[model samples]
Each structure stands twice: as structure tokens, then as C-alpha cells.
Target chain A: MTEARATMPPGAGVVMPIGGAEDKLGRMTILREVIRLAGGSAARIVVISTASSLGDEITHAYLQLFAGLGVSDVVGIRPENRDQAGDAALVATIDRATAVFMTGGNQTKLATVIVGTPVGDAIRAAHLRGAVVAGTSAGASICSEHMVSFGSGGSTPKFRVGQVSQGLGLLSGVVVDQHFTQRNRFGRLLALVAANPGQLGVGIDEDTAAIVSASGRLEVKGRGVVTIIDGADVITTAYTATGTQPLMMSGLTLHTLPRGAIFDLTTRRLVSAPGLPDETEPPKVATLADVPEDMRPRTRRIAAEGAHTTTAELRRRPASS
Target chain B: MTEARATMPPGAGVVMPIGGAEDKLGRMTILREVIRLAGGSAARIVVISTASSLGDEITHAYLQLFAGLGVSDVVGIRPENRDQAGDAALVATIDRATAVFMTGGNQTKLATVIVGTPVGDAIRAAHLRGAVVAGTSAGASICSEHMVSFGSGGSTPKFRVGQVSQGLGLLSGVVVDQHFTQRNRFGRLLALVAANPGQLGVGIDEDTAAIVSASGRLEVKGRGVVTIIDGADVITTAYTATGTQPLMMSGLTLHTLPRGAIFDLTTRRLVSAPGLPDETEPPKVATLADVPEDMRPRTRRIAAEGAHTTTAELRRRPASS
Candidate 1:
């Protein structure tokens, strides 16, 4: 089940952007693909925890999940501020990894901590050197050239309700939003893209992932759809609408891609049907029993806490829900 | 082209909710239909100006529009506060109208002034007595039982980001959001309905109308689509997700109805193909000259000022944009 993905020539790896709360436990379809793309069981992965505010727990959860899936060479890195983001030690960690996965938190905080630093450069370098790069939620958002700094939620694109920030430019000319359908962020993303017509809008629904091959083919994976909003033919009031007056935009095109759908970002068009070959069935869905016996109680405790479940618990939950 | 709509027996009229910025000048498809439904040349329409903050200008726009369409029997009424909303004079004006139209502005202010007042009661009474009841933008929002009080815009639905208030309750078991696709409000409406699963979510795109007949048939009209979000099978974290964490939801169904589509609100199912007979071509799109000679300057001034164009200019502007 292994491939030479990790040793592929520079500029050939994939960038996977996940809508938040991806199905980590049942069928681990997206995650297993991440591992296979990175280097299967031999993958050396780096988990980026700068976007997360919950600290090391988020990092630890990813480590456990990867280990349980048989990838024990994974490590986590956190560059707390611009100063830490410049740390050579952190850059080295990213440089050595076959894959880099960013956890979700505050995208603004993530960009503020690392956007222009050495760690950010290392990430770009890793992608250029054929290492798969992936991010979930906030992590997913920062993989593009432009990122949503923050905004209000609604169906209308009111004036001044949203802000934009720079992202790590691993993928360009598109603004990516995670937790698409679950969060209902269609408006804000439309507003941002309307304001900047050069960039297309990519919205990923939770439990879904859009894997962008270096060839510009974006394939949808997992349970939900990836919505692409193209503003090329738009006529919008994004420039002149005053106050809370709703922006008037006509001619924008929207394409929703479900599992196995492929889109070409370079041409800004939906590719013909029949996307890349589907991955082999996910390595069997791991249950709580698969967690190291020592780590079982911790997983149970996180679930008991109720409101926020760590990645470890989410990865081991029963499939029915 | 006129029908005996206004003279129909009690409880047999329609409620038209127009997403804001319905074209007034070019095509005038929606506004013309409003006139035809209200009795065309014989109609006496009441303009409810409580939702607008722009003094009488907003009222003037509609009066001019309907007049240009040959319905000269229109009057404007403004209930500035709850006291005015309770005024018997205002109620009497509503009592005599063949149709009632509420303009767009702020829903909260509109509701604060007239939600349970005599004027509001009179409008409802007019509907029951076989008169058309219609609203646009903020006015459109108040047609539903649960109105969005105030909220931010984005794709993700965060806790406390949105608040709902009582509307005119002209339509129940659903919350209506206007400027749907143009405004990108899918998330907030989804959140509101996710919390109150008992209520279905209806989002109307700008320049569009959803006309609910007394028979519980909702027909789509105008240029855009009406999105119906049904959460009957939803499994969500709306009740438990902590601050800023994206709510997890699954099994929600979304149906987008383009112009000419019909939906059965009672059964919450899309009606079969072959909707109602289409309306005749609109009385020629009104040009600026159709406006009274003296009103042309104000209309031109509103456009020349840029940024914000009055409804009059919006109505008369050449339709190509």
C-alpha cells in the first residue's frame, strides 16, 4: 500500500485543505489518504500547532492519532510568535518532515504568529520540495494566498462586515474557507471574492477535503462537497454599497463538487467527470480499543468533558453518528 | 391582464416577500406583479414606511413606481414608534387598502415600532380580508414568524453571532432571509433553524420573491432562487458547541428553487414539475420619463451621487448592468 510520494521530485506533492471537524474516527478516509500521500507507514510528519490556542493537547491528539494509524515518526511544532516562528530549530523540524498538518484555531492568530517568518518559509519550501501539506479548519484557511481574517455570519454581504489577511501562499489565486456548509459562510466568502475578483472562492464543508495536486487539479474527498465560487463575470456593489445595504452581485458562478469531483483551478473550470483514481479503502476504522491502553482514560475524559472533544476522541468514536 | 385578485373573498390572497433590490426600472417584473395582484388600475395600496430610516423618500419611490405602473391609488403611512403604530388612523388606512407594502430598512426598528401594534394588526386583517401583503428586504424578513434581529455575516455559525426576534408573523414555521445568494446568509439562517428545528429556513435571493398562497403553496418569482433548508433529519451541536467553535451538523437538506419553481410549505416537499401558469410579459419596463417630470432630478441626483442609488434611480436605470 506504499508509494514513493515522499521521495517525489520537488514541486509534485499535494496540498489538502479540510473543512473543519473532519471524520477522524470512522473510515478515516481523508486522513488515511494524507498518510499515504506523505509516505504511508514510513512517513515523517510535522504537526503545526501555532493556530491552536488550546496548546499542546491539540498536538498530542494528532500525534496519538497518527501513531495509532501506524505512523510513529510524527512530531509537533509550535512557533508561539514572530520571534519563535523565526527559530531555526522549528524550521529544521518542518524541513525534515514528509508532510505538514496544521490544526485549527484562530486563522488571524495563525497568520500573525507565522505568516512571514522562517517557519512559514519552511512550509512553503516543504511544499515546493514535494512534501504533502494539509490543514484543517483554520489550518485549511491559511493554505491559500488570501485568508479570511474574521467576519460576521449571515447570508448577506453587508459593507465592512469582513476582513481579509495574508495566508501562506501554498496555493494561490483562491480564498479558502473551511466548515463551509456547517458554518454557512457562503456570504462572507462571496463578499471577499467579489471585492477581489482575481481570486476564486473555495469553501470546504466539514468532514470533507479538497486535495490540490500540483497539476492544478483539485479533487474532492470525504463526505461533503467543496463549493467553488467564481467571480469572473460578476457585477457587484462590493465597491459602492453603503452601510448595511446588501451588495448586489450578478453573474457570479457557483460549482459544488461532491466526493470524487475534480476542478481545475488554473482554468477556473470544472474538469470532466472521472477524477483521479479513488484511494484504496481506508485502513480499517480504528476504535477506542485501538488506542494504547494507557491513553484510553484520557480519551474517555475528553469525551466526558462533552462540549469540546479532542482529535483523539473524535478519531475513535463509533461510526453510526 | 388584470385579475379580480383584490376582490377575492377573505383568506384567499397572497403574501409576497421580495428579497431586497428588486428591479423597479428595468423589466419591473416583480413590482408589476405586485400591482396586478393588488387589482391593477383599481387597486388601493398602503405603503408601510416604519422599517425605513430615510424619511419619506423610500415611500416616494414605491408611490412613483406603482403610479408609473398605472396604480395611482397608493398612500404612505409611517408609524414612528409603538404609540404611532397603535394609532387608529393608521389602522384605518390599512383597512381601506387592497394591498399593503412594507419597504426595506432595519427589521429591528420596524418590529419595535409595529410588531404587535394596531397598524400591524390592520395589515394582517387586510391579508385575511383578501388583500395582498408584501414586503422587501427588511420588510421581507418580518414576513416570517422568527425574524433575524441582528447578526454578523460569515460562512461559519458561531454561538451568539446571531439573534432572532419576533416578526410580523405573517408566515409561520419558517424564518425568511432576504438577499439570500447575493448576501451569502446560508450559515446564519442554518444556525437559527438548527436551534429551532421546528422552524424551516427559507432564504430569498435579491430581486426574487416567494409568494405564499393561502393554499400553502409557495411559488418562486423574479430573477433569483429561493433556498429552503430543511433540518428535520439534522443531528447538530447547536446546543452544546462552545464559543467560536464551529457547530457540527449533518443530515440537513437544502433545496434551491429557481424562478417558476413551486414548493409545498405544508408538506415541506418540492412540488412536482409544472408550476403555476406564468404571468404575462411586464408592462413595458418603465423609463425615467415614466416618472413624473418633477421627480427626475431627484432620481438622477441619487445616481450621480454614486455609492448609494435611490430606489427611483434603481428602477429607472438602464437594465443592462
Candidate 2:
């Protein structure tokens, strides 16, 4: 059925990692971007509920969320174990998807179940062909090559206090951690980067997303800031730090960016964000009952500036010859 | 000259590990007890300031505190490196002392500088021969076989989020952490115990001390509570948890104890605290301005009960033939 509809957008290799608990209701900025990147109303989104412990609950939530956003064709593929992850029908569903989203739960369980299987391959193939790939929380964490398996968050990085596992490899040479600032996960992410100094550590705060394009450009979206930890110049005592001791990590560069910020991941530099709509009408928007309580005045300013990309705007197709 | 004075109380094999920042001022309960354990004014105390980064500052502070508590023969030994730790005169001073106290700083540096030196051997020898061995903060941490070198603290134990290093081994099969509650070090201690289930994890809150007697009976002293983590029954997924992922640690037992509580470490059971002084006098004690502000009503109640364990009481000699 999917093959019959030959108008599918060639995958743009877009990846959006939402730092768990992104706003599902008001504005739904991050989620809407997922839909927009996947070709809006014409999108065929496949929700991978493999990481979710809630079983059908998470899958149903995404399916309903996309449907509410005016996307009619959305489906869910849940594989409980490796055997099911390789199912031909499930792999086919991934192949047909213009967007693939993995929900949050346990990254270890998710990777263990599908990483080497046919479903994982299909997801990668779809991304390679230009499909949008996005995830939330554990799902977001698994998008990187070196995934943070589990660890407690703290202010100081300790030696070997965290565990790292292989991930889906959608984002190479990167470590992604969701619910960053909210959970005080700076330590864990920094530790991961210190352990693997060559990798980039991208930490997305709650309600935010770091959207990476095929061109290696990353743009911030949603209400929260994205923290980037660059360890290229880090001089760490991680090698000599014995069990649970705090590590001495010096000279690591950190960048904290909010919405409308553009970063060039390949060049390891910040690309100036395009001029956003004028931000002078914040107080008036704050008085509007429709604005989310969690969305600060700054976010409200963006909303008032007409920076919102509505479903109608997303549905408009690009002109073709 | 040391042999001529000859009134050393035979070693009591007492090991007191104080969480950092014990009160040095009004009603110094913890420090006074250290003086009492070391035979009051007649005590010959050796202060080891190897862990301190502030040089003479830490040593001077300890010397004054001990002197104020009526211990006159207090002397300090500052070893910046392992070579200094092996000094013959320093080892000789430890040999003649009735009690040894280690000051706080960095545990990793302390252990690295002294653990294998002659001074380290003398500390163990002094402890074995019954001299009271006490330490605070980093000093307290090095009493165990496995020391928590450094790590950030959190509520959940993640996979390898902490580092562990070798310690002085004064308290076998144990790991000690100072400023436990004050620094929120519960997670690191739990992670340490989860990694080495055979070792007992003792987390002493600031201003509190866990005094382990020769018989392995642990008595709590001072204002703050002592957190004991027993992981012998813990069911953990640490073996398989890759990278900084939170571990599934189940069935671990936790005991939070305060002053006057007694515990048998060997048997892992609560040894009923000797009837604590009546708690009825708390209101009157709270009204007394002489008491420290940080001392809670419960601690004041004990203080009013004449449970002060005065230096005069310690100065009384044991009846000898």
C-alpha cells in the first residue's frame, strides 16, 4: 500500500532528539516539527514502541498525537524481543515510513532488542534514504553511536560511575542525553564525553529538541535550552582517577543555546540563527490563556512574533517542476 | 623522653570516622569524645595532614581544636608525597601516640601519598595496638579497604557513575564517605556497595561520627545521622548495564541512624543503644543559648541528660594492680 503512493519525499536525513517530557499539549512545538519534517499531512510515520515499557500505551499516545496534528496515515511497530524485531512485516512498515520515532523507556532494553536486527537495519535504511528520524528520552539517547546505558546525575564527573552502551548509530560520534538540566545530568554526559573525548555530548533540556540536518547543521527548537559539551580540548585525569573519585576535566568548551540557535556540528562552531520574528509583543501573549504556564515569557514572545509554523503552513507542498 | 612519661592507655582499637565539618565551637561533642577516647589531657595525639591541599592551615586548625578540647600533647605530621610519608621520625611519632587523627582534603591524594608508606604501616600498627584512630572528611574516607575517590551524588545508583580507589585498610570490608547527607553522597555510596557487595558502605553525615570499636560494634556520635547501606541482598543488573544507564538495584537494605544508636557491623544488626538519656529536657536545652544553632532538639536532649562524657570522666584512671 505504501509503495503505491509514489509521492513520498526522499529522506532528508533529518534527526530530532527530544529531551524527554516535551510539551505534548500547548504549542507542541517539537512534535509539530517532527510532523513537518516528515512531509506534514502526507507523512507516513511509524512509531517504534520497542523501548516503551508501557507497551501499547506509548504507541497509542504518539498515534493519537500525530492524528490530532492532521496527519492521517500513522502506524506503530512494537517488537518485544530480538526475534520480533526481525519480523518481515515490521521491517516493511519501517521501510514505508517517511518518519520513524522511538518512544522513551529503557535504552538498554531497546538497543538489546533491535540494534542488530532487521528492524534496526530498516530504520537506518529509511534514514539513509531521507526519512526523518526522531525520538524522546530513552529514544533520544539511543540515537547516538555511544549511548548512556544508565547512571545517576551529579555536578562533578566521577571515574567510571556511568555505563555506556552501543546505540542505533543514527548520529555518529555523538552522545545524546535527554531531560538534561531538569535531571542535573551534566555530570553523566560530561563523564561520557571525558571517557570518549572524541565524541560530542549533546544534552537537550525538557521540552526541547536538537534537530540535526543532513548537512550536519543543528537547530534548537522548543522552550528549553540545549547544552553542548565539546571535549576536544579537555585534559582529564580520568585515566588515573580510581573508583568513584571525581575526575579533573579541564578546558572543555560548553555552549548553552535556546530556540532559534543554529550550530554547525561538522565545523564545531555556532552558525548565527536567521533573524526570528520580532520579539517585542511578549507581555500581551503572556496574558493569553492559551499559552502554556511552563512556557516562559521568552517562549511566549516567539509565539507572539508569528514564528509558529502552523499545520497549514506545513501541509503546503514545495513547488515542483 | 617518650618512654620516661609512660602513661599510654593500651590501644583501644577505636576507629572514628567523622563526616566532614564537625563542630569545633560550642559544646564540641565529637571532638571532646576524641579527647576522651585518647585519655584526655594526658593523651599524646599525632595529626596526619597528608590529604590537605591547604598545607599548614588544616594542620593548625586541628591542633588548635584538639588543644581547646584539653589535649596538650598534640603534634602534626604533614606529608606532601610518598617519600615524606616514609620519614623515620614521622613513623616514630605515630608509634608513641595514644591516638592518631587524619584531617580532611582529597581522599585520592591522601591514599596515593601514604597508603604504602611506613607512616601507613605505623597507623595500622597503632590501631592494632589499641590507640584510637580517627579521621574526618577525606580522612574518614580512607579508613576503609576501598575508598570512594570521587563522584557526584544523586538518588539513584547508575551504572559505573562512581570511581573507587584503594584506601588505608584500617576498617576492613568497609567503605566510608564523609559529608554524606550534606553533599547528597547517597548515590555514590550505593553505587560503590553495589559494585562490591561484600563491603559495607558507611555514609557519615556532617558533624557525625561512626565509632567502630575493636569488637566491630559501631556507635554513632554527634548531631547528624549515619547512613548505612547493606547491599548483600541487592539484586542488581550492573553486570549487564552498559554505560551511564541507571541500574536496577533491588532488595538493598538501608539504615539511617543517629547519635546514641549502636550497630553490630559484623552481624549486620542493630545493637540496642544503651538507654539514651531521657528526652524530656529538650525544651529547656533548646532555650539555652550556649548550645549550637545546628544542634537540633533531639541532640540537645541527650546533652541535657549529662551524657556529655566529660574530659574529667576520661581522666579517671583504670584500677590497675
Candidate 3:
């Protein structure tokens, strides 16, 4: 993985920096999406479990999941070292693949084993030539130019407790954090963006995937939402702070994109989704009779028909007194 | 905080480890419980927001909340550096505090500034003299002797991604993780316990509180469940591997405790809870009338009798899943 700007080239295939912690068997919304991006059942996919301790197990798992999805020409690759990462046979497979998927593991291992190798170059070439490229967890972390190698967190964002590393640079000017909501990584991600200022922070929730097109259109798809932190125009003295302290940044724009919401990276705005703030009327609430028969008696879950996770009304409503 | 075995001193007062992301005003069950433990309105409580960047805001918020609850003597402290941490004025106040409450922020900030200070010593002294000590988030992370300083996580446990550091030794032989279910810190906690089999991992969910008496009885409180990972008799080769890898451990017991459940930390068993696995017959399902009038038309909610989150039968049945 070359350390370059996180911009997608023209005619480049779809970039799937899948949020980590995806279920391989149940639902399979994400894996199936990757296959669709790779041209459906006819797509030739290469599964790389280089970051896993159970590499063989993960490789086998992906092979089963992909095969079950009706893709016949699926292959698994496990590169132990830089030498294996540069294997001519593996490089050739990567070049011929329509989709490349990397499994979850320690991002550091993935970096040492595959980054800067021949296979890494092939993945780049394949991605540039219009082949779908996707990774989960550590894989997702590497999708952006800057990645979070390690970080200490609690409830609030602070200074000097996070480490950033170079990634494959498929998406530049953005740092990706996986298992986002599930791991409560907002603070750490905020800390990174505060220091860097040049980069945006994309925290992807578990079971979610961010579909980045060559034209800079980002579509969120999954069970949860994606949190986008824009700190470019923010003001903070955290960069000049001498000792460790909590972060203080103002004017940072936060956007939450739920499933089916479409955002444009180039425009830095929401392109398509229901309930835009400028709309005349937002989504309406439903009564008990409008709910599903099974769930109506116990609860009436209002169907959220918008790109946002919480409305202005909901956010104003206090969690407690 | 001294690094010691995880055992409570006989004369020590009650310790409340609250999970993170709680609403201070509404549904303030955990906070109310802490006040009650401190002997109600007559209690002198100290609020430490040193762990928070919004410490001033948190202090003000808690002061109002506690005052609303009828606690007249509420003091606030903000120790930013080591020198301030040893402030005699603050130490004197902490010593006399009937209940000491620390707010959430970055755990590292809490540990570094207060770990070896006079303030930390005063807190221990107060607790030993029968004063309640309560902490939330970063505060909760610092209650145990060995704290999870940093950890990379997913849905499954892995090796080397977790690192433990010293914490305020209010409790030993146990590591605590906040936002357990919501943030999915289970894998990270499991990795910690797998490596150090003698210690148990307590993963507390948000809005919840675990009240541990000096005699070692633990009662779960609040809206969510507490996941306890016991690795006392686990066997694993994960401890041997050097690089990042999948964790391998067997015989690890998992227990989920909800509100009203009482667990005996001394005996490493649940003393009082309605549904014991050894019971001859489980609970029966409820009818529509068994639920409240408002909840009658849809799903039937089983009244969680005596410590169960739901019930034995409800646990056996599936939700929307």
C-alpha cells in the first residue's frame, strides 16, 4: 500500500472501506454488497486473511460465505511475511481478481506483511483498473490515507493519547475507525482529527459499510449509522498544549449518515436522503395501529425515514432529567 | 493507586462502579443509589471532575443534580496536575467526604494525575473509614487495581491488542470495562482475563452501576446488564504467542447480571437470583393481560420477577431476532 493522497482516480472501481465486525453468515448484507460491486456472481474475488491469527479459519470462512453467495471463482490468500506478500502467484491472482477482500485482525500485522509488497502493488493496480476493493476492521482502517494504530479512550476526546499510521491511501484526507459506535471510538477519532486538522474522521459502525465511488459519492449501507467528523475549519489550541489534557475544539461539523443515505465527499454535503433540514416537513410519528402486529403491543417503534440518526427534536430531548 | 490483589478490606465502605454515558438528570437511578449509600441528605459528597475536559460543566451539573436530590453538602474538586493532585486543601476535603464521586473523561488523565497523589490516598482512607466511593467511565476504569489502559477490539477476543496499567486500588483481582454491551468491549476484556487468569473481567453496560460492599457482595443496578467474564479455570495457549493472534481459551464462564441481581464476589457465585440453571422448571410465558394496559395489544412483556432482566422463559425466547 503506497502512502499517497486519499483521492479516488477516474474510472477506478468502487472502494468499499467496510466498517469492521461484519457477520459472514447471518444477513450477509455487506459481503453481498461487495459481490454486487464486483459484478455479481460472475466476479472473480480474492480473499486475504493476512491480518488474522486464525488466517486459515478466516480464509475458509470467507470462501464459504462467498461460495454460498454463488460466486464460483473465489480464492483465499494468506501471506505470512513480506516474501509471501510478494509471491508472483499471489500477485497474479490479485491482478486477475474482480474484488479483493481483506479480513479483520491487528492492522499492524497487515501493514508489515502486505504493505509495500508486490501483492500490495497488484491490489492497487486492480483497484485502479475498476476492480472492487474492500476490507473489514483492520482492513477498514487501512482504506484511508491515515489510520489509527492505537489509542487510549474514555468518555471524552483528549490530547496526545492516540497514534496515527500511514495506510493504503485509497481514501485520503480521512482517518477511518472501525467498530465505531460499538467500541465508543468517537473520542479517539476526534482527538486525531483535532491534531491533524487536514484530515476528516470517518467512524464506521459495526455491520455497516461505506461505499465510495470513483466520482466521490459515499453511500452508507448497514444496520447502523456512520459518523463523519469534519474538523478542517475548527479552531483549537490543543496542538500547542504542552502536557496531556482534554481536547477543546469548536466549529467542527458532525454528520450522521444512516443506511441508504448518500453523501458526496467532493461537495461535503448530504446529496440524497429523506427529511432534509430544508424540507417543509420532516418525517411524522406513527400510532400503535401503524406498527407491526407482533411488536405493537409491547412497543411502537417509529420508522425513521431520514439520513439522520436523531432529529433536532430528539437531540433536544434529554436522556435523563 | 497501589497494585495489589483484588480483595476488599473488611471495614471498607461500599464502592459503586458506574458504567459510562449516563444521563445526569433523568433516570438518575445510579446517582440516587450512590446518595442513598452515602446515608441520604445528611451525606457529605465530593464530586471530582478532574477526569473530564468539561470538568467545570460536569461539576456544576452534578452540584445541581445532588442538590435537587436534597444533598446539602456537595463539594467539587479539579486537580489538573501532579502538584494539584497533592493539594492539602483537596485532600482534607476528600478525607471528610462521606461519598466521593468522580465524573468521566479520559481514563489516562484520571490515572496519571491522581494515581500516586495525596488526593488518591485520601480517597482510599475515606473508603476504608466507611465512606462510599463512586466513579463513572474513566472514574469506573480507575476503581480496579489493574486497569485496561488500551485495547483493540472486535466481536471476538484477540491477543496483544489489550494493555493493562495501574489504577486506584479500590478493588483488586478484577478489571472493569465501561459501555460493555453498547460499545462491545467484551472481546478486549476477555483477552485481558485470558492472559491473567486469576483476575475476573467485569464489563459494565451504560446507565448501570455495580455496588460492591466491603464484605464482597456485588449488586447490579440500572437499565442494562453486566457481563462478567470468569477465566479462573481457563486453559489457553494464547499467552504464549508473541505477535497479534486469535485468543484460545476454554472453560471461561460468562454471567449476565441485571438490576436487583446479587452476586457474591467472595464465593465467585450468584447468591440470590430467581432463575438458577439447576432449577427443575423454568418460568412460563405471559399472556396479553399479564402486561400493562398500554402494552397489551402487541407483545407480552414478562414481569421480571426478583432479579431477572426478563425471565427464564423470556431469555429462552427470541426477540425480533
- The sequence of per-residue lDDT tens digits that candidate 2 reaches over residues B106-220 is 9899999999899999998999899989999999999887888989865445567678888888887778988876676756776787788888788887888999987788888
What is candidate 1's lDDT per residue for B1-321, written digit by digit as tens? 111111223375799999999998799888988888899899999998888889799999899999999998999998899998988888989999999999999999999899888888887788888899999999898987788887765554556756899987878777888887765676677678668777778889889998888877888788766777666765555676556544444445555566666777767766632332233545455555665543345546565766442333334444343
Highest DockQ among the candidates is held by which one? 1
- Per-residue lDDT of B33-116 in model 3, one digit per residue for the tens? 999999999999999998999959989998999999999999999999999999999999998889999998888888999998
Candidate 3 residue-wise lDDT, A207-286, digit = tens: 88989999878888886556666665654545544444444444455555666667667656566654333435676664
- In DockQ, how does model 1 score against the reference complex? 0.11
lDDT of 1 by residue, A117-171 (tens): 9999999899998999999999999988788888876555556666788998888
List the candidate 1 regions with Cα displacement exceeding 4 Å.
A1-10, A273-321, B1-321
Kindly list the per-residue Cα lDDT of model 2 for residues A250-272, writing each as its tens digit: 44555555677777776665665
Off by over 4 Å in 3: A1-6, A242-244, A275-321, B1-321
For all candidates in order, the CA lDDT equals 0.77, 0.77, 0.76
TM-score (chain A only) of candidate 1: 0.81
TM-scores, in order shown?
0.52, 0.47, 0.47
In TM-score terms, candidate 1 sits at 0.52
